[model samples]
Target: MLSTAFALFCFLLAADCLETHVHGDLFVPDAILRISAQNISIGGIQRYTTLVNGSVPGPELRVSEGKVVWIRVYNDMTDRNTTMHWHGLAQAASPFSDGTPLASQWPIPPQHFFDYELQIPNDTAGTYFYHSHVGFQSVSASGSLIVEDRSNPPYKYDDERTITLQELFNLTDVDVEQRITADPLLWFGENNGFLVNGKTISDYGVIDNSTATLAVIEVDPGKTYRLRFIAATALSYTSFAFESHDGLEVIEADGHYTKPLSTDLMQMGSGQRFSVLLKTKSCDELEQSGRLDYYLQVETRERSAVATNYALLRYRDTCNLPESSVHHLPTDSYPSKKPIDLPPTISGFLDYQLQPLVPNNFPTTSQVTRRIVLNVQQFEDGYYVWRDSNVSWSDASIDSRRYTTPATPYLVSLYTNQTAYLPKYDAAIANGGVDPTTQTFPAKLGEVLEIVLQNIGSISKTNVTPGLLETHPWHAHGGHYYDLGGGPGAWSSEAMEARLQGTLPVLRDTTMLFRYNEATQPDVKSGWRAWRLRVQNPGVWMIHCHWLQHMIQGMQTVWVFGDAGDILKVPRREVEGFLTFGGDVYGNGTHVPERVHFSEGG
Candidate 1:
């Protein structure tokens, strides 16, 4: 039912190649991270996990646009060895501070610490945060990593609210892991209902008679407010709308600026961040009678059983409210016009499918390159007495042994002066041997090209229906980029070239939804696993799954770019290895590590 090689990687992420102590600005723990759990009731019952420093939601670490910051994380949690990755941070370009264990740096030995430094870019702004980037950032392991406006924020809100939308549960790691691992019915696409900041539906055990399922944001009706919303769900795209409000202007997404798109409903996926200027009315006008009475709401509409808020928008200028206004003067720099109407139809539009959005095609100069198939899977493993559902989070003990049901990020690390490899169809490619798909491209200087994505999963067919291709949103660090086009999985080199000549797709520095199933099928959504981008930007760029846990579990890699003059020569290890093996004598990857012993396939 499974290949031995894959199974080996799963159980043990490969023995270390080098035994070395790492030092730098990375987040290496100074001591063991202490995380405690308590089972509580809201609608029913749930367990809330909190990190050390004693906050259910961890402390917020603020950095500026241009600075070199060092993070030293000491893993204090018991049971398993761990590491932290800076999800969405530009890693490929930023190498040392990438934060990915094993791939970019060494895994922090249990009871030990590791460190590295991140050269935060000068232009970084908007709202972006960081978490364990190790696993399940959707759970309790993450917190906001905000790069504030070096100059005071232009808005004048009474208070600043950084709300992270995530799910929580009462079960232990063992409890949840045992069920999902044992039962195939509880497969890849599952949602555990719990909110770290928001309340639960069915009154789950956390809430009783007094509290509501909303995180309140108070404001005066006259002044505009800035609400930076971050959604960190494993598989949920959320929307926010207001009934008794003027309008909301979207200024940023995924921590980067975008062509200002105004809308009441702010939509985003995991790893995506959005900010809106909530233009509120004045406080005095409300003192007489109609106070700023409002509601705040979130729904798991992506899946069937959705949740609504008891206090959707309950805000007023009461004595209990915090200072909502900032001392900085508010500026009316970007005037708000009538909101853009959502498109009603695309009936006759000529569709060439989609292609990658890098300027020009590929590149004439690529110093280092690599192609990876983000293989995702759903197995038909349990056919006997095992059948479990009504899935909830696991109990504490299960946390350590837990692995994922779906396919996680298969790493493809590249170094300067190395020839990247791409695999072809039918035949799966490993480190070297022969790449069914291989290419050589050029890397230019001073340009920071954002990468576009496509699906890269195994093709699984049902007897009667089409196969499934898992789609994940492609996330970048340092900055966000415009999204052009993404091809259907069927595209090869030839057709992709033709589609590039058409009109450009929309530019989005924010997080844009990537679709695996057709739009009409709401229950099924995913993004391309196979995508490409130009490494014009300098520094390390981290590319990984938006599902933070997947990234921590090894669904991550790094890219490095240096000045054109400093660029190293291509390492022809693949050419050398392939030639050495002779044809027909198979090998795994071109850059074969010197450790493995192999010969021609007898």
Candidate 2:
């Protein structure tokens, strides 16, 4: 009897050990990140802001396409709540991990933890990024998320580099938010300087200083390098180019591979990414001719307030030279000068025709099932508040009527079949105090929805000389859309049809809604941008302006697909786990109030 009992115990222990080993091999995270607030210096001034790990712009996370990635984010922030959004990622059935605060999930409060298990779908692999989505925290807590295609890429490149372009301000995120609340006309905070991979060139001299270390990309003479450019700014629209380098072939935009279109300059809005191929000349030949270095220049376009920033692209052996031996181009020769002075038009060279690398059977415009017009305008009570389709997007606010006892998120309401705050399209026009029913736009599953984002200037103040015309970079979650061509001002069906011209549109996740110019022509109307989205993802998706300030002041909305039946298709355990595990524990049921608040009238 004793010998039989011992055998049974050994069998049970072996089974348990085997199970543990198998689970560990399958479920271990590819990368673990810690989100915290840290003081970092920029442009010679030190300021405190949220950061991932210990770096501003965080760390680059790379995962193979179609692989399951387990990411554990530990929030070490003491005061602020935080959530990291996987920008441009189609979370598909995993809506709970979408990371929009009060939409998909709650903020991972101080000393809390959240584990995100993301499966990068084989079909949807491209350049994306992760950043804080809670309030103004994303101003610093951002990083690149690259999904590399496991199969051989169609484009030819010998090497690759990631370039992150961001705008920095002297004020803290809280202070910036306060200023914007006081005066909505501030838009995004005043841009102190621009940065390339978290560093800037010295302001005073041609010498490279320790304080201002330019991000360097080393290259061999005879090899082609793939440059992945991410415009991760909170506000600014940038024009990017490499000085004295003309053959920049843009092969990918927003993760979709496109036909190679060579251009001297590329324009990127906030949350957009582009991959360009740069072929280097023979280093021996260039050295023989005395040209050894070049600058990758990025500058704010369509606005005069931001400064230009540059990174060095040094030849492999050129670092032996003195640090002061830097090459500076003439101010007039910069790419920013051309785009700023030229009329706003899509260049076949820059905005080339993009088609999917593996062409799937997608419906054309004629097959679209629904059409929605999103009119972008400013609503003024005392301060400027942006509205879409006359509905200012509502969230759980202290002063708003939508605030609930448990602080229900907009997405949680949809998942739980709670319709108390679901906004109706028509009622949102006049209803004021945080009515969710007015702000929500509903759709059906697998429906092809066409959204025409029309920007007709603001009512409060003119941001630029050409009226209330301001650029808005619109981003959609949970899906990629086909970017149909846009035009100036209100688009009629006929105009849209003409713009399509019976061709397939480029697939992208973020698109810039350009501002209209009266000076271009007297008959020009306010600017408009159009995109066709297939509502394949069932979860409530947040669509908003990537301009962080605009999104804060109600320039956002949600697209609800199907009904409770469709929402229930998601794993019940995932929904419950998110509601129970995610959220601010310190505030209990109530939300922590912002440092600044607008007056009731404002």
Candidate 3:
């Protein structure tokens, strides 16, 4: 559904704009990411997952706060299209670069490239990550993005370690996608095991002992180390704890500083990040106890069954010990004895306790302009499909050929005054939720919104009983929101009123909607989480569950911020001729000759 005016405008300008790369301010690529398919061994199995630069978890990207980082991504995969999403950073300045397929921009064609200009604002420095937002590719196409505060950092530590956590599967992306979309939908089973820094020794037994090496964290005797934990899981809620360690204190979450809170274990779903300080024990104390190494245990939470993995935390002096000695540390094997008791797990209370170090700037209830409530439900005629309220959103198009290639994205439509596909505020006001056709909730320039997300059981066409309720890690695309609070049962205005009284809200891009045990809480819907935010970013942004299977089954919605006049004011060089179907109409400036385009869409 390309608007006539926009199509004509492109045709008219196509003749004269061949040589011009772009006018106005332009930022070149600071880093180049060549995405391709690679074979990597995880837990003794070779997973056919897409990788960035031939690595499973990609590379660690470090940038400074209050600066712009331009990264050019080339889709080297021969068959599929891809896009990368900056998980924790608020991409307000560069809305088109937010990287949601068919929402912010189109998927980069095979052998084509797209440039992402990310503007990191001041006072936002902590653990963050970037991942492929298309389909289930993010299971392996993710890496750590750390923003350091050079001017003034809040905490002090001797050194830092980046731990990218994920669940490794034995199946390929195509196999899982085909099974999910088949006539009788098949669920992708639980991960084989968890990974710490793209490596782990199986706790069950040695699998491919030659290739299975546990991640080792070598530290001096008595020094504090900042451990940045990034959960890049496609599914499962993962928790991490160090054996016999008592000096762990969390100092950051998402991309903001948090008040120091001590805890025995930290639990995080996919797309969540946290930084904690771990003070290592003295060598004398460890020698007296007859142990120079400890197990960094990782286990799954809120699953049908439990799966555990381990890594080694070795003292620096232990590396010099003789191979035959008792204190020698082996990085490829597990300890002889496992801990009898695991630590208690944390849930929604993690958000409640860790207050933001930055001052609270959230608007009061009286200043709020709009409020929306959405219930996450499942529908199954034969296959499972998730919906918000009554609308089920899909990324596919009508024609079979254009299944992965939809029409122009909403951002392009809004920028070019293509009103046919845009969402209307009046229509959204008339309807309780978003219009099913548009699949968007419209917001004005500076409106404050209070959104409540409730978790409900499944409903079917044949009047089947409500299905099981599970945990959903919901993540916002454009910006972070203030997490008000969450509770069991349905959402109530009374609970909202009580939680807003003299409370300082914590800011998080991703928050969990917990699931209650069906046996304990029978005949009851499980949990709900609330958030408050002001719509300042202008563009199309998606909010959905971070779990890839739920998202693939249609558990997502979009928000259209500002009107045409506001959206059209964005710079012309930023939007036009980037990765649209016209194939860089501005000529050779956007498309580098290093790679030849073989296909248009996935």
Each prediction's whole-model lDDT (CA): 0.41, 0.67, 0.74
Q: Write the per-residue lDDT of candidate 3 for residues 1-602, one digit (tens) a residue.
A: 23476557657766211123332135356887878987766666666889988787899999998777878888888898888899978676666578888687777777777767788888788899999988888888989999999676788899999988888877788777666665456776778788888887544445467668888878877789999999999888887788888758999888888889998877888999989999988756776656677888888888877788888777777334443332745776666766525644454657567788879697888888888887887766656677776655556432232122346777776666556767868888778657555768888888989899988877655544556677889998877899887877788879767866766787889988886543222234667889988888777888888988777777788788787766555345434564355256211335442211111101
Q: What tens-digit string does per-residue lDDT give for candidate 1 at 165-250?
A: 76654444334434444433233334445353544443344334333234445564555666787776665555445655645766
Per-prediction tally of clashes: 114, 6, 0
Which candidate leads the pack in TM-score? 3
10 residues in a row with least lDDT, candidate 1: 383-392
Question: Model 1: how large is the Cα RMSD against the reference?
Answer: 13.5
> Which candidate leads in lDDT?
3
lDDT: which is higher, 1 or 2? 2
* Global local distance difference test of model 1: 0.41
Ranking by lDDT: 3, 2, 1
- Which stretches of model 2 miss by more than 4 angstroms? 1-27, 183-189, 201-209, 318-352, 394-398, 401-406, 417-438, 461-467, 518-525, 570-574, 581-602
Model 1 regions more than 4 Å off: 1-44, 48-52, 91-94, 114-116, 152-159, 173-213, 283-291, 310-471, 477-480, 485-513, 516-532, 537-542, 548-602
> For candidate 3, what is the lDDT?
0.74
